[model samples]
Target: MVIDLQNVSFKYENVNVIQEITAHFNPGELVSLVGPNGAGKTTLLKLISGTLKPSSGKIYIYDQQSHNLTNKKRAVWISMVPQNPKLPDEISIPDFVMLGRNPHLGLLQWESKEDFNIARKSMSLTEIDYLSRRKLGEISGGERQRAMLALAITQQSPIMLLDEPTSNLDIYHQIKVMKLIKKIHTLKSGFGVTILAIHDLNIAAQFSDRILLFSNGSIAADGMPKEVLTKNNIDSIYGSEVTIITHPEHGTPVILS
Candidate 1:
């Protein structure tokens, strides 16, 4: 599934939030959207998730147009993990993840054995099976992040859209989450694509197959990690002097301030 956007512009109350942006995200790729604070990362996620339609131009998931994709159908195709989610405190992690199955069920349908199996498998994939019985509020921050990823996995969408999936996690959990994302990307099954709006440049470089940097409501740079995360581009968009060196072990771009 190629997410093809052409001159896509989004506005709020006559205020332009995303300017004419054109880009293509290919199938079976992991992409990271990176930028400074208030660079419209969240807004772009909303647009891609079918919450907001572009004011001008077009967005296509495969050959289908964005406006034609209803929320119900879109939810089935793309699962999103938001920056901050308000999970009900009393709900267990497994129960919370089961909610992702709503897209596959009828309005009056009840949870079936298959649903529980899917939810259980998702927990296993995220390595959160031990926390399955724990209340969402009782879990640690990293556990909560993993729980959210479990929910996303259970949704079983071909394309996953995540907003700050690693926010507030410790370094260990951060690496864990990135590795899980990479695992999903390389699945033998036809899980198509994954896109995330992230803040950490180093993780973006390390995990993402491609990086798109936004500035002034447009894509300032788009390419592989090595090609885009240069000293000049970082200084221009982030407005800070920084040096970028290749990581000795991983060969990914490492930025030093």
Candidate 2:
């Protein structure tokens, strides 16, 4: 397993945001976390990224206790594109993307030519290269989202975690971004893991190798999209009736209401 969560739980202001949960993420899997609002999907991503420590239980990344890894070391293993992250408005897009290289740099070391190359390549892959000179504040929400993804891609970590990556995008951009992520996952012949907390059930079903359905701080279902995204599961967890159809081309589940 690339990541192992052993009875992990997290609390915020005395409320259990994430209850005792055990999960494992294997390499080369594109996993999606899906659920209704306040289901603790984002909180779970934060825990896995080491941004928030679990109140109880443990998280192991490649068999190493997560808490024992330094921030830099953790960054080298996992890269995250947080939902609506705070950005430096005045910073150029390229400059912001270069920050992704920090984990690989020595203290007081400036970014090198190779680092710049990697950043450039990531921006190109994310289709944000044209916005290199623009300040982050000058871009649209969708543009900023892509820039954030570019930054995470530049990190070159083995695990990528994205929180609502398509939230700010339009239909076209959403498909574009999702395809880019899928392409990146397979670039190394399925060498890494990409996990995203996404609200779009159809998108999740289309792209994910596995689906983890979260409900009230715990996993309601876990399995292949076809198995976990059934009508019964959706009606129970989401409290809404949704029709499940198979995609003609992809053969993935399509959720309809």
Candidate 3:
């Protein structure tokens, strides 16, 4: 397992956001966390990214206790693209993307040519190289989203976590970004693992190797998309009527409402 959570739970303002959850994520898997609003999906991502410590239980990354790892060390292992991160508006897009290299740089060290090459490659892969010179504040929401993804890619970590990466994108851009992510996961001989908290059920079903359905601070279902995205599971957890079908080309589950 690349990440192991042992009875992990988190509370916010006396409210249990993530309750006694035990889960394990393996390498080379593209896993999606899906559920209705307030289901603690984002909170779970934060816990794994080490941004929010678990109020109870433990999280192990590659068999090392998560809490014992320093912030820099954790960054070297995991990279995250948060739902709504606070970014500096005045920084150029390339500059922001290069910041991802900080975790690997020595203290007071300037970015080297190798770091620049990595950052450039990331921007190209994310399709944001055209906006290199533009300030972050000057970009559109979709553009900013891609820029954030580029930054995370530049980190070159084994594990990547994204929250709503396709939120602001149109259909074309949505598919494009997802395909890019899938391509990246397959690189390095498929050793990378990606976990995303996404609201789009169809997209999740199409791209995810496994689906984790969250409900009321717990996992309602966990399995391959075809197994976990059945009509019964959707009706019970989402409380909505949805039709499940198989994609003609990909043979993956497709959720239609």
Candidate 4:
């Protein structure tokens, strides 16, 4: 397993936000966490990324317990694109993306040619290369989201966690970014495990190798998209009526309002 959570539970202000989530994310898998608002999906991602320690139980990244690892060591194993990242307005896009290389560099060392090359390639892969010289303050929200994703890609970690990656993106960029993420997961030398907290069920059903449905701070369902994304499951968890249909091309479940 690339990422493992063993009976993990977390509390904020003495209230449980994540309740005993025991799951393993396998290599080369793209897993989507789906649920309604306040389902703890984002909180779970934070726990896995070691940004938030669990109140109880364990989180392991490639056999090393997250709580025991130093912040730098943890960064070497996981790279995360947060839902609402705080960008430095004065920093140029390329410079911002290059910060991802900090984890691999020695304390006194600067970004090497290889590091810059990796950053450039990540920008290209994310189609943000054209904005390389632009300051973060000049970019649109959607563009900024892509830039953040580019930075995460440049980190070159084995496990990638994204919170609402498609948020703020229009339909075109949403599909584009999702496709790029799918391709990145398929890359043999790149990320081994990709986990995303997403709200768009259709996109999740189409791209995810597996889907985890979260509800009330727990995993309501966990399985392949076809197995977990049924009409009954959606209705039960979301408390809303949605029709489930098959995609014409891929035959995956499509949630229709």
Q: Is candidate 1 or candidate 4 better by lDDT?
A: 4
- For residues 1-257, could you state the per-residue lDDT of candidate 3 as single tens digits? 89999999999999999999999998899999999999999999999999999999999999999999999999999999988778888999999999999999999899999999999999988889999789998998888888988999899999999998898789988898788778888874578889999999999999999999999999999999999999999998889898888899999988889
Clashing pairs in model 4, backbone N/Cα/C closer than 3 A: none
- Compose the digit string of candidate 1's lDDT tens values, residues 1-257: 46888899998898878999998888878899999987877788889898787999999987799789878888888889888888799998888999999999988999899999999998999999999668988999888888888898889888899899888988999999999988877872544789999999999999998999999679999999998999999999999999899999999999999
Judged by whole-model lDDT over C-alpha atoms, candidate 1 comes out at 0.88
Residue 17 accuracy (lDDT) in model 4: 90
Best by lDDT: 2
lDDT, candidate 3, equals 0.93
TM-scores for the candidates: 0.96, 0.97, 0.97, 0.97
Q: Report how far residue 27 has shifted in candidate 4, in Å.
A: 0.6
On a 0 to 1 TM-score scale, where does candidate 1 land against the true structure? 0.96
lDDT tens per residue, model 4, 39-118: 99999999998888899999888898889999888888889999887877999999999999989999899998999999
Q: Which ten residues in a row have the lowest lDDT in candidate 4?
A: 183-192
Better of 1 and 2 by lDDT: 2
Q: Of the candidates numbered 1 and 2, which has the greater TM-score value?
A: 2
Ranking by lDDT: 2, 3, 4, 1
